[model samples]
Target: MAELHGTTDDRNEGDASRGVDRTLSAVLASGALGHSERRAKLLRYLVARETSGEGDKIKAYAIALDVFGRDETFDPNSDSIVRVEVGRLRDGLRIFYGECTDPDLWTIDIPKGTYRPTLTPPRVEPVSPPQPAHLNRWALIILPILVVLPLLYYAMRPAPAPEPTAPYPVLRIAVMPFEAAGDHPNLEKVAFGLYTELSLDLSAYPWIAVVSPLDPNEIGADYALKSQLLWQGDNLQTNSQLISLPEERLVWSKSYSIPTTVEHIQDTQLQITSGIATSLGSENSISPDLIVARNARNSKPNLEGFLCFISTYRYAVEPTRTEHLRLRNCLEDAVDAFPEFGEAWAALGVLYMDEVRFGRNPRPGHDSWAEARAAIDKSLELAPLRNAPLMAGVVLSVQAPVQDLERARQLGRKLMELFPRHPPTLALIGSLISEFDGRWPEGHDLVQQAIALENAPPSGFFITPAFFAALQEDDAAALAATAPLTTRTSETELLLKYLAAARNGKTEMMAEQRVLLAQKDLSSDADLVEFVKNRRFHEELEASLTSQLEAAFLVKADE
Candidate 1:
């Protein structure tokens, strides 16, 4: 066995500085070249490459193969050998960085597609200091579960039933984006599909509240009565999203990047959903009827119906009409096969809402609002506390009579109370507070949290956070917050920085922004809004800034 060794003098160094040395030492000791004589040769290769800054996977592999020459070609197919050794190396590097004392020392990261080391500056630690006291208390409390039988018993005890007279508030939950596996072309679709299915499955639990992803308008709301779930792909090859509710900490996380068959997907879904149900302290399992409802054929008709429903509910954002029609037809077929399906009925109602919202004419003699009301009513009749009816209630509140608003508000509050951390509920409540109640700060916080939970790697929901921050007149905060997003462009950042400067009364910042914006040819309101939102600036600022820019440009154009 290779002995792990480190210099004692390194411990006396500051954390950052020590970390760098430890990392370098670990890399040297990784035994990458081979097990015997080749180990020294590998080290030499690494040293040479590091010194020259020209290390790569091919070179590393070639060196390793050469060292083991004629005995056996370096077997790249040996999963166990590669994984175990690489894992050890990774652990060593982690420990080195984690214990480093100096913040300025550059660290080496092994990038994919090459064995070469890439030198990068250390990550900036978040400004918030650790809650040592709280963490210590938690650690102490968690320790000794094995010896403390009574505490273990108490910890494992089922939650007591609520009193009959006491109203049980509806639970609300947010399902973060799920991580995908590998470079699959349909990775996004898979994540979205999982999200949709999980949302549907959870919707069936009467005691558990479910939130839809359709409502992006209400992202920030009170976090007093919610829980969050984070979903991600293992090994960063798949998809992942984090979920958090107000007041409550994270309750569940899942990664699904391992190679899986169809059965595995179903079983994993069941296990995860079951875990979530348990976390919510649900006494009852999902209804067998709901399970049966999911068994319909994956035909075009079913797909169309789902599409129509989604299109209607998401009409405000204007999804592609081609996709919308395709989904609508699929769902319609689903309904045709299962006329008694409560979810189908509820979705049909949402589809009708879409038609009205988008001004799409229905087949002869179909009244969109009337059909919507009927479908929702049927869904409620079938599954009173299920997610579909709850969603229908939300839709009704927006489209129905003033009296229905009270019912919608009541249902909304109930859903929020049950699933307080749910993204859709947060978004809904935030929207209500912003548009109806004029509680901007409260609404802003809710929306911000929701966006954090849903936005993924390549395509993020940027506008919501930017607009909310803009409302607060905190452009600098918005710019700083959005600086790390991979999907946003430099021009977008520059525009936001300019807006922040304008809001902060800094003309120099605005001048810098103008140059970048001009260079990028992104002078339109749409472009400005995209940049502002990506930076979490206010949406209204787009028009206001455009006017200012046009006036400024006119002066320049004349001069």
Candidate 2:
């Protein structure tokens, strides 16, 4: 009759007699079952079957009939009534256990992917007080001195008149998260990438200070910058706004459509950056001479293939059938337009590899894998170790169905040696691959260095640290890293909250997350996981990492 698994029993008549009474009493009187009659009936049915070791027979069809009055001929696939009610039963158990304060109580749960009910006895770790008496004593002695010294110093100083504030408040501009126009995960990445690029570009002006990625509406900044990113037809459309927060009006707004070919990407970016800086009317405006000088360094700003390559590069970040087909077609046209463009060929190769990895083919059994190899080889032949080809080749090394981790590592080292002023995007992707490959310490340091080198990393960059904290099982660190992320809502944000809440045993806090996750209209759990982890493409990448680990172990053994 005892709820705990290791309860004392003679394993004879005494045990047999007690179990019958215990099972019945636990089922009929349990708080989890005391609520809705239907839920109670379902719980009793599941629990009774489980205790008698016939739990396997209590599948969805059986439960539908016995608990919900479904006919024997009921089809669970067509009728979601059983699924819906079972979900409530799970929530009911959670609610029951959440309200119970007893530390030693055994709670019932129906874990995901199964119908069996489990009785779990609470296992509590005993808390201990801090034992470092020396540090505690030092804090007591220094606390008063630290407080009084500041007060005494202030009292002896003469107060001066406050300085006049600037009329425009130095044009403090806060960049809100760029809105992604689609539900696709790839679009989210593209939006975030653009957001980071714009923030970094704008921050170059001495008069502007980019606010942290919090809600712009709540901030008291002089100006607020916001953007909406969309991929429609053959162009990347960005609707940007510079708002005067004090006046509560839009100061400047422009909608730009950059061709997917990306020929004028740098020019478009430069224009937006300079436009905002010039419009601010600050003394430290960017010099027109410098803009001209910067443009002069861009060798082929009007190149047809490179512009298309830019859009293709961003599109492949997280790909789908319709978009990737368009991407591949665009890449083909780019190559045909500029046959000598090595980067275009490399891009075409990467696209084919990714399409194969995603199980999408332009044509059935087209042998894209072979085409990918040939195209990549030809690209390297045309522009060996050149910046454009090298960048494209490195991404292929990391992302293709057959990852060349050695090549990726070499490229990463070579990139650092070359010392690009800003290579944070590559650093970010490498860090992701490191983490995915279970090299957590390496990944953590790589991301740390990347963030330190660039002040305005992509908005999604925050997830790296949160993920690191989660892997280390450091709940407090995870919570702190995720605290700044409360200004937005996404599946990623929700999953992070759920993780942090679960680690702290905040079941009440998890209630909303549970509801949101289980909403009927929410996408499938698998898709949500993929979106959160940024694994929209190359679905089997992580699975391959497992084999990589095994191969690594074998190499270590041989060594």
Candidate 3:
């Protein structure tokens, strides 16, 4: 590699020094980049090194050791604090100066794949996009058993059933007596049949408990499902409404009309049950009947482990008195109960990251990050399917402090080949598309494929497309991507709205969402992440939002 050169003594050194100082001051003053203390330090450290004529001495390892406080044996492959921060700093610098800094002033850059800082006078020419910061030649694909494991989960079992009384308050549904109105002969039979089907379908959800022939006093459940049946000409019409208990809030209501035949009743009930269960927070595509049947005959040890794994997965993503203890206990219980549960180990790796990511690890008695890293390694060793561990590794690779991007990119390609149309597969790789790798086209395509694959994907599925659009400054595309989430009132919904409105210069819409965010008590990006109820959505969204927040599309509105 060529050493970086500067003409300090020969070419306006005093003026250049003053220009650098002025620029650094502007960068640190904005909420755009300095919100992250490490980013600010990275910029300052690089600028200082350049000013002192020590740019050639700057290396990835040195930055890792000196600025980021890494130890002597810092590994570029595993601990990527320096790499991720450098990438952010580069992007932030462009966005900050593009919006706030003067055009005639100096432009400073620490180019990708190197730590050397370059300072140059303003030029009118357009610069080519920088390369990805940690681009390494990806290792050859190693097909592992974890490949297509998400598909295997389809074959494994349907879903959840435990005592309704767990420590956590679960979503509950009480299928009240389906009333038959006027000329509704054999209506009781239809109502009873629908009740049985509803009970079975709703019970399949891991977080949902069902109460049959619900009594009025069952206030403990979170929600209640009620319906009325009417004969509409040559058809049976089932009108259903899901209501929140105690609060009496209308969650969702729908009407379904199908032919009054045994075949239609059976098939239509399944469809309606599936729809209702989904609205109640079950995002898994598996039908409720499948879940009910699977849990009924699951092997004891495996079932115990699976239950703990699902619970841990839930607790990790969504915030709820969340301190990482409950998730840790759940994963520990899974591995202790069934030592062969590799998915549990993979999830444990994510939870260990939860400590560092969420401030759960301050001054640890143990090396939690190392332990977390080992968990994924063990998961890869033991997992019968590769997708679970591979996906977990992909998440770790995405600016997560100890990122493993090359390995993740390799695994992502393998998973993409194995399960092209799987929602999870599309969701994972699609969210990772970046200008850095020139993968945004493929990434956006995958997200679109995922959207096409599922008729009713979760609200989080729209997130990746919207994010990619925002970062690219395609405000129209960003608005188009978030059209699906407009009806819902979620933290993510509010976030996308704020982003779209802010980027589109829809000042009134932006102001409206800002109020909604305050109502949700989400004060920061971290707060928005904590409110994430979807794991796939959270990891990918968190990965991109940091840089997106620093980009030029958004305007600061009057408070």
The best candidate in terms of TM-score:
3
User: What lDDT score belongs to each candidate, Candidate 1 first?
Assistant: 0.47, 0.57, 0.59
Where is the poorest 10-residue window by lDDT in model 2? 290-299
Task: Tell me the tens digit of each residue's lDDT in model 2 across 129-238.
Answer: 77686688889889999999999999999997664222112234777778878544356555665575566565444334455435443323456788887876566777
Question: Is 2 or 3 the stronger prediction by lDDT?
Answer: 3
Question: What's the TM for model 2?
Answer: 0.39
Ranking by lDDT: 3, 2, 1
Better of 1 and 3 by lDDT: 3
**Candidate 3 stretches greater than 4 Å from native:** 1-303, 312-325, 357-368, 384-386, 435-438, 486-494, 515-559
TM-score of 3: 0.40
- The lDDT, on a scale of 0 to 1, for candidate 1 is 0.47
Q: After superposition, how far is residue 223 of candidate 1 from its true place, in Å?
A: 22
| Candidate 1, position 93, lDDT | 40
Estimated TM-score per prediction? 0.39, 0.39, 0.40
- Give candidate 3's error at residue 325 in angstroms: 4.8
Tens-digit lDDT track of model 3 for 1-559: 1222542233356666676688777667643352345667778888888777688778889998888777898897655456545654664565456455367567777654477878775545668986565543321232343466766887798675553221212333566767776454444444554554455445544334454423422223345688888865567788888877567788778887787654566566666666675565343233444333211211224433544454543343344434357657767887777666676788888777766554453336876677777888787777624455767777666535445568778878766654433455667677765422436666765665455333344566677666666565567878766766653346656777777776677778776776777766666555655544223333444456544444413365242
